[model samples]
Target: MQSSTKTPTAGGRAAPAPWALVSVLAANMLVDALEVSANLVALPAVGAGLGLPVPQLQWIVSGFAAGFGGLLLLGGRLVEHLGRRRVYLAALLVFAAASLAGALTDSAALLTATRVVKGFCVALTAPTGLAIITSAVPEGPARRRAVSLYSFFGAAGFCSGLLLAGLLTAAGWRWTLAFPAPVALLLLAAGARLVPRDAPGTRAPRGPGWHATAGGLGLTGAVLLLVYGLSHLAGPGREPARAAAAFAGAVPLGALFVAAERRSPRPLVPPVLLRHAPLLRSALGAAALNGSYVGFLLVATLHLAGSGRSPWQTALAFLPAAAPLALSALHSARIAVRLGPARAVAAGAVLAPLGYALYPRAPGADPGPAGLLPATACVGAAFVLAFTALHLQATGSVPAGLQAAAGGLYQTFVQVGAALTAAPVAALYTVGRGPALWLVTAVGAAGACVALGGLAHRGRPRARARP
Candidate 1:
């Protein structure tokens, strides 16, 4: 788990240039992010082209999430067991293939399947990329800066996806789908050249055998059901009975997973990590922030559209929220290093609630771009301050061997937060924009408290154990 003096590479080849390595990995991160936002804007066009109903069309977005969120834990375990570089490269190739398939597919189900495949591939690549960074880069300012760059690219990719969708969907939704394939291919070629080789000693310990496999499958199934159930709960046509059934199913599967892991010599998730305060707090804080931001976005988008603004105008207006993100993220590492990740997160957390509170709350209120500027700017700034810090807190202290597993667990929290929050926020928006914004503000406030709570009794020394 210790930091290596030199970047790890296969067959004793020279380490890739740091810039090249980070850029390639960050680029892949961008591709994963683009999958989420680009399809969002293209959804209506996709439905029209495929003659799909509104309810089915929603799957295009939710399905990707299901795949991404469901298998994240298993993906993390795979990265550890299979080799980070190997898993990352293989997943990238599959992601590119899926993107190509998605672009060409005429059938709605097939397109959705392609999306799920791409998402699953992303689940593999994301944690591996982070694991690579944690292992290749030395800890301290260098690792912090590398993580900042990685986080920045993810933010930039989402924003770019929105703008790209606006342009590509003009030609056809297919163009939007096809664009990522070439970009992913370019990244794949670069990754093959740049990603460091994994050391042989890094694989999971021998002897868990079927216990490890069963635990992993059970955990994956449980998460899959949870995400799908949550989606059903929040989808346009809320299927409460089905959602309840899925939740009920997840309980036993999850219990079985716990049992299997307890018996396994090497559990998929190390039992100690379950008690890791930093990881748990970071996951909770990230979840709260992600959920609130996504909820806010949903409310803001609907509010803009209802006020008679064009889609392009609404997208452009939201630029204030996404444009400054990369810049802020670039500086987050420095901030976290200085103030500590916990305090930095708290600082960022405060801005979001303030932004939400400042916004006009009335259902009839038309907050044009000018009126909405404060809220968007605040939320954007919040991400800049907290996002990287949260990442730092979550994985920074984890042992090198468990980096991917830790990253997966943290990211699962984030994805679940975004997915679960968006649905309820949408359902609430139907009740009233005021209530929806209030809910977002409340979530943000709670997140801020969680972050601040981490700072309690700062610098207090732990009591010594008896000799």
Candidate 2:
């Protein structure tokens, strides 16, 4: 669990170069970004090769989403106990292994299971990488720029998958599934070099015993169910009663997670961070924005391509929305600074919903580039504007030591929102696009309300100036 090299920061020595940490974290994040989007282009190939049914194909994402969402907190905790370097290498090895398994498998069950296990491994390392960046760099303009670039790169990496999807998918699903292995291998190598060892300090690290493990298992179960419901509900005219059951089962299980976390000594989620007003808003806000954004996307995608457009054409038509996420992530910092973290959350909550509301009018009846382009841009911009806003604000005040945990908690909600929204709103489209779009509009607008509610607390006269 100990790091291999001596970390200068631990001894009041000069810290590692900011870029070093950023580079390392970027690689860490890049693979995660790839994992989320890479599978999209291969879905058709996967179905054909494996004799998979369309509805059951949800496992490509839902399985991973369920797994990733379930284990995030435990991932953060593993970092705390294991240290970033050890956990990062260990997880990436597992990640690469799982990716390889996904590549070679023709069995639907096996492939889906590999993706799920890969998600679990990714869950372990993803948060830890960001935490390492935060810990390596001092909080200031340097850390701000570093974090922004890292996040921006992550956002950019998502779009990069789209560009590469063409080449990789054309080559075959095996190529797409297996491609991430080299990236993971590179990160694992860099991890060995750039990462410093943590020498034993006076304080002993806690062993991640039964309670922590059990709490994580429970949380993972609940989130998996939550994502399953979301994706299942959204699939094309899928089974209604079954999806409803998934949603219903997930709800109480989620409650049980809250209960378990409270009871555990070494809780997967720390209580203070969980209950923080601004932080909670950010976590939930990321979830909302992604859910609405991705769901609307899924609907728009199906409508455009389902109407007989080529796969490449469908990807091209959606370009406007896809382009802005990386572009706007750069400005995320300015938004954070000008508005301060809390107000930024409020801003995202506000803009994102309004953007969703405009969806019906977007791309117009003609489906011309002018119409679709503007809408895609608006929605894409909304995510960066809001997501960055939330990220900056959410982690604004956490103690240096808890940075990893905060990241884990933040992403936990991110995937949960995605998982929860994917199918439900898509299912709503059955009533019509008019109804489905409105459903997303409503969901996004609700996040804006939550953000503003934080503002309400801000205005209540400061609690009589604390006497």
**Top lDDT: which candidate number?**
1
Per-residue lDDT over 1-467 for candidate 2, one digit per residue giving the tens place of the 0 to 100 score: 12224356645976456587577777678668767666764565676678765445556766776678777777666676777778888888888888898899878888878877888877877666776777776789877777777877787777776666656866777888898888888888888877666546612378666666777777767766655565456435566687689778867776777777777875777777756666787787787887777666656654554455544555566666666777777776786677665676676677766666665543334455655666676776666566777776677667666665677788888876766676566556554677678878877887778778766665553211110
lDDT of 1 by residue, 347-398 (tens): 8899988888878787678878678999999988888788888988888767
All candidates: TM-score: 0.82, 0.83
**lDDT scores of the candidates, listed in order:** 0.75, 0.69
Candidate achieving the largest TM-score: 2
Residue pairs with clashing backbones, model 2:
3-197, 5-197, 70-220, 230-423, 233-423, 234-423, 321-376, 363-371, 363-372
Off by over 4 Å in 1: 1-21, 43-61, 104-112, 133-148, 193-209, 231-236, 305-311, 357-361, 395-404, 429-436, 457-467
**How does model 1 fare in lDDT?**
0.75
Alpha-carbon runs more than 4 Å astray in model 2: 1-21, 44-54, 135-145, 202-204, 229-252, 340-347, 357-368, 397-404, 426-435, 461-467
